[model samples]
Structures are given as C-alpha cells and as structure tokens.
Target: MSEVKKIATRDSYGNALVELGKEHDDVVVLDADLAAATKTGTFKKAFPERHIDCGIAECDMMGIAAGIATTGRVPFASSFAMFAAGRAFEQVRNSIGYPHLNVKIGATHAGISVGEDGATHQCNEDIALMRTIPGMVVINPSDDVEAKAAVKAAYEHNGPVYLRFGRLAAPVINDRPDYKFELGKGVILREGKDLTIIATGLMVSEALEAAETLAAGGIEAKVINIHTIKPLDEELVVTAARETGKVVTVEEHSVIGGLGSAVCDALCAKAPVPVLKIGVQDVFGESGPAVKLLEKYGLTAAGICKSVKEWY
Candidate 1:
C-alpha cells in the first residue's frame, strides 16, 4: 500500500471561503479571535474588508453573523467547536436557528482529535447540539476535497448551516479526478453484500480501510460516506440495511447522539437489524497524542475490523 497525502479539513474550509469571497461579494467571514487556528485567517488575508473579528465573544459572533445575514449577505462565523457550538448554544438556537438565518457556522477542532486541548476543548457533542435545532443543515466532510465542496454547498444553501471541521490531518479519500459532491446524499465508495459500514467525517477513510481488511477475512463490507448528517440520505441507508441485513456505524463523535445514533434511528424506523456503533463511549477525552487517542477509543481501522469480527 502506498502512502496517501493528508490535509486538515479546516484548511480546506479556509481556502474555500477565500474562493467564495472572490466569486461572491456578498460573502463575508467572521471569526471569534482564533482566525488562524480555525483557518479563517486565509479568507481574512484575502478579504480584509469583508472579514470581521468579533473578539473572544462566541455568542456575540453568532448574533453578529445572524444580523449580517438579514441584510442579504452571507456570513461564515468561525470558532473552536467547544466555544462556537457548546458555549453559544442559546444564541445559536434562538438568534440564528429560530429565524433560520443564512449564517454558516464553521466549527473547527471538533471531536477528540484536537490534541493537547483535552476534554475542555475537545467537543464530541457538536453534531448532537446542532442537529437538534430545526432547519439547520449539518455537514461533516471527510477530507480536504469534500470539505471544500461542503463549504461551497453551505454558501449556496440558504438557512443556518453547521460545518464541522477537525484539527487532525485526514487522508484524502475523495481525491478523484472527477469527484462531484451532492448535498444531502450519501456516496457508496465500495459495494458488498455481507454487511454495510456507514461512516461520517474522518471515520469514512477508516471505514474504507476496515472494509479492505474485512475483505481479506472473507467478509464483504459495503462502505458508505455520509457527509451530510442532519437530513441523512434515508433512501440509501435503508437500501443498504435492507440489502446487507447487518450494519455498523463509525464516527469521530460520541456514540450517543452523533452519526451512530442517527443511523440507528433511521434503521430502527425502517429496517430493523443488528447495528454496532463505533465511537467515543460516552466519555470525555484526555490530553494525549491524537493518533493514540483514536487508537485507545477504538476509532482506527484495526479497531473497526475487530468490532466486525466480534459481531460476526
């Protein structure tokens, strides 16, 4: 196996925002002090006049973005996931979500992959918090290419959008010469009949690798990448469940209310099957190397393969 190039999704979000600024003058960016960390600094450097620094106030930033959206201008508000989604929960729920404003919340440093930040900074519940709000489009792209495409999609779509990005560099799985992204649709990367592996965000690549290992063990596993989490592609999920008769969900978030729970909710309503959720087991992350944390939490390809073996 050859080495694959890796890039953080936050980098893609920043570059994409800059491109959007060049194309659409109405596009504006706002950051709550951590522009460089969130990678919104790339857009700020390109469009200083359009960029607004809201200081360290995450709630104020959300409100300002909501206000900006009312004037028919698109605002991309960025901050760490813990502050943006967790701290500004009330403001986001009322100010932006209630009105369904055209504000894009670019939440960086999501999941336990935020090394050295520990549980205080690592956010594993942003998806659960954001998805609970009505009319909010939730997207967690898997890699650099998908992240860039997701930024463009969020800008085009009206209403509130929560774009979850991570700090760790992820393998470029969707780096195809001709790769197109469709909103609210799940892409089937590999087809199999024994079981289905549905994953979102960084877990997509892990799921793919797990599929390869499972194939070696004579267990054919279908791999599906679900970037859009809120309005999940029910048809594809149901079809996969119906065909495979067994399912496994993988995510970088907690197993409670993230992708795993969302998959179970969809499957339980339509096709009942034995489902396994692979993610943070309802525990806070501690300070450690990101790779080691993933391995400890059983979020790697080997861990996924082990879970499959146990299930079978």
Candidate 2:
C-alpha cells in the first residue's frame, strides 16, 4: 500500500466546523476578518446566522467570543495564529484563559507554513505564547484526520482551547473513523531503542521519515507523535525518554516557545536526556514556498537525520 495521503489541518478545520454546526445550534463561529484565508468561509456559508465575521478586530473578537462562551454558548474564534495569540494575548488571557471559558480558538496559518505570506503572518511563537498561558489547552493536530478528531474533542471538552494548524498540506497519518481522543495522550507511530524522536504537527510525518531513515542506517529511533501540545502526554514522553538515551524534538514553530521547548521542559523535570531541537532558530521567515522555507529552516527529514548524526 501507499504511504499515508497528506492533507492540511486547515482543510480538516473547515469540514469539522460545518459538521459541528449541524449538531449544535449554539455552536457559533467568530472569524477575525480572515474567514476565507482561515478556511472558515465554509462555516459562514453553511450556518450564516451562527457565523459572526468580526472584521479585522482580533483583540476585540476574543473578548466577544469570551462573552458568548460565558453565556453557555460555544464560540470558536478563528483567525491567523499571530493575531489570535500575539495580537490578542491580553483579551484571550483575561477574558478566556483566566476565567477558563469554554471557548475554542482556531489559529490557522501557523508556523513557517504560511510560506509566501512571509514572516509577518507566520505565528511560530504562538505555541510558546499559548502554552505559557494558564488553563489553556494547546493542541496542534498532525493532519486532516487528526484535526477532525481534535475539533470534535474540543467541542465536547468544556474549557479554553487553542487549536493551531498550518497553511500547507501535511500527510494524513491517521485514518481511524471511530477514533476517540483523550487529551494529554500521544501515539507511538513506531517503536525503537537507540534514540527517540519526539515530534508534533507537520513534523510528525517528517519525523516518521527520519526514523525510517535512521533504522535503515542501523540507528533505531523511537518515534512519538505528540498531537497535543499543552496538557501534554508527559507519561508517554517520559516512557520514551527512559527507553532511549538520546532525544530530538521537531516542530514547524520556533525552537524557543514551541513543541520542542514543551517537550524539553517535561523531559527535564521527569526524565532528562540529551535533546536536540529541530525547528526555526532565532530568525524570521521570508516569502517563499512552504517546502523551501521548511528546508531553509532545517525542518525536513534530511535535517532531522543530520541533527541525529551530529547530536546523537
């Protein structure tokens, strides 16, 4: 059979919002002037009344979303990652995060994946921003299937959530129709011993490839695909760390405040190991193709292999 078919998390969010709208009348969508770009246009078209386009006012939209949630309504505020996390930090923190409102924040165009939109739109620091906030459930689904599952799980769970997705297409690693998600749980795509590759979001597929390459090169790598960022599956990570002596973390976001940092923090207190983080270093992205940007920032499978060769 062929390897898994790649699809972006944006496509999954678009479809899942429509599906959620069908079941819950109180499920509303609030987009901060980027419905089409964020792929929330489908929800607006399907449920016009429930969809609120809060044009260009990200900070304000977050407060309004919190208000809606306080009224026992589920509001999924959609926008680009930079605006949602960086631009609207205070509103999201005081209104939603502190109060612990049941609001679902969908931040699209995350990481260097926005490509041609350049560094201005990329939200590589969002993971660090959102993950730092208290009472916030941060998650980055790997592909379409996982994104769909995440949306459903977020809707059912009663609390504040930040679901980040990329602008580019990523391979679909999951195909389970009846998949049930328990927050803070991760999946081991392949088991190994020599080293461990801990990855999330778009990097999961690349990590899988890196692991395969490592095995072929006589280096067994245990691959842990962590779909959820906050409330992270520390148990799985600890187990993996203990199993393997060397470790590497990969993500599309920045090395400081993204998946790698979270993994490192968890692994340090619980189970420390030699960790090499594979992500964008202290630099902003330029306007280029998504794949080109990823390659330039040392985020490809080949990059992972090189890091392992040097670090481990």
TM-score of 2: 0.97
Candidate 1: minimum summed lDDT over ten consecutive residues — where? Answer: 174-183
Which stretches of candidate 2 lie above 4 Å from their native place?
Answer: 1-4, 176-180
Per-residue lDDT for 3-83 in model 2, tens only? 657777888898999999999999999998889888899999999999999999999999999999988999999999999
lDDT of 1 by residue, 137-210 (tens): 89999999999999999999988999999999999999898788999999999999999999999999999999
Which candidate wins on lDDT? Answer: 1
Report the C-alpha displacement of residue 147, candidate 1, in angstroms: 0.3
Location of the lowest summed lDDT over 10 successive residues in candidate 2: 173-182
Most TM-score-accurate candidate: 1
State the lDDT at 225 in candidate 2.
83
